[model samples]
Target: DACETRVPLVLCGNKVDLRDCGGRRGGVASEAGERLARDTGATYFETSCKNGDGVVDALIQLARQMVTTEDVAVQTSALRVCAADQKRPCCGGGGRKDV
Candidate 1:
């Protein structure tokens, strides 16, 4: 499956703090990161590991969604299994097993 089809994605651009010190020209780093996020339908964050900018915030956001969505998926799967096991021959035509 494509990354965009997934429920949650975080796009992080590291080493933002080095731009000025390394003499890198333009705001291309941030712009390119945002463009990639937009194209992939994911959240974008610019961070400097040296200074810890936006790192914690981005990780927390992703973690929060992961925990919540995983719980919901587990519950849904359990429900599907229970429903499938409850199937009876008289409940449907031809006595086909529930999927």
Candidate 2:
């Protein structure tokens, strides 16, 4: 499903520490990755497999966004239900409930 849906992709270039020490350049393909991310309106991150750089932060940020989005969805649904109930006479009182 994810392979078919091409929205909200996250491109992570890992193992940066091994690149320079092994005669390989880190982020060499960063531009290409960035271009792809930009084209798809996705996020790009460079991480080091050895030292764990940017890993926690990236995951935390993603989690935070997910939580925020979920919260918004919950609130929106609650509001919709409240509005619908208010429009109906047999579904409890029309007044808002105290939280």
Candidate 2, which ten residues in sequence have the lowest lDDT sum? 1-10
Please estimate how well model 1 matches the true structure, expressed as its whole-model Cα lDDT. Answer: 0.79
Q: Rate the local accuracy (lDDT) of all candidates.
A: 0.79, 0.69
lDDT of 1 by residue, 1-99 (tens): 133235878899888777787576533388889999999877899887789998998999899878887887787779989898778445566666659
Model 2, 14-62: lDDT tens digits are: 7767667767666536777788768877677777767998788667766
TM-score of each: 0.67, 0.66
In model 1, the Cα lDDT at residue 31 comes to: 82
- Candidate number with greatest TM-score: 1
Model 2: pairs clashing at backbone N, Cα or C within 3 Å: none
Model 2 stretches astray by more than 4 angstroms? 1-9, 25-28, 90-99
Top lDDT: which candidate number?
1
